[model samples]
Target: MDQNKPFVTEFLETYKRHPALWNAKSNVSKNKHLRNLGIEDLLKVCQEKFKDANTAFVKRKINNLRTVFRRELNKVLKSKTTGSSVNEIYIPTLWYYDLLSFTTEDESGRVGISSLDDDTELQFT
Candidate 1:
């Protein structure tokens, strides 16, 4: 853990090293028992380094991270269809944008992505 990095950045960096935390299409990521173990493993690291994290906090942070990443990805993906010029296209400015790219894959084997519209509800397992 680097002392100078922000907690979110460190969290994302640590999370990137664990595919079960982000790669939904993976078998390991799909198993509830394995996913909980992976989350617990991440919580341990956060507790050791940040000292203020708990299971609830870790879970919330993970959800928030994924939510934002999905939103940004959706923006970028949607921008391509709007026929915007290169300069007018939505470019993700989120620092963790690229780091969370693993989640951009369409795990359901669909050729197209449904929008993450404001009216749509996201179900977290």
Candidate 2:
């Protein structure tokens, strides 16, 4: 087991719990008051692990991780369109892929179904 695995896992779990971090189209993510909570979450984790952690350092780290995740996810999604079969689709090799898969959920595409009304009609026997 890699020594850094635990650290990465911890941060990923933290990111998952904070919807403002990954669910870009979510109301919480878009809200000015809540959007930055992801950064705050990471800052807390970093400060606890490394006493010297600062906002700039944590922000940069989070951005880099997000960039990597986006790139990797794009590759996988692209493969689905280009590949002719399941065997040809790209499989993520990064250990963090599983942890980051939650980001693939498209929150923006979700829609609510409204109830429809039906007019009653009289029938003759």
Worst 10 residues of 2 by lDDT: 114-123
Instruction: Point out the worst 10-residue segment of candidate 1 by lDDT.
Output: 1-10
The residue-by-residue lDDT of candidate 2 on 39-67, one tens digit each, is 78877888777889887987787677778
- Backbone clashes per model, in order? 0, 0
Give the winner by lDDT: 2
Clashing pairs in 1: none
lDDT of 1 by residue, 31-99 (tens): 788777777877987897668888888889889888988898789879988998898889898877887
How far out, in Å, is residue 26 in model 1?
1.8
| CA displacement after TM-score superposition, residue 10 of candidate 2 (Å) | 0.7
TM-score per candidate = 0.69, 0.74
lDDT of each: 0.77, 0.78
Error of 1 at 5 (Å): 4.1
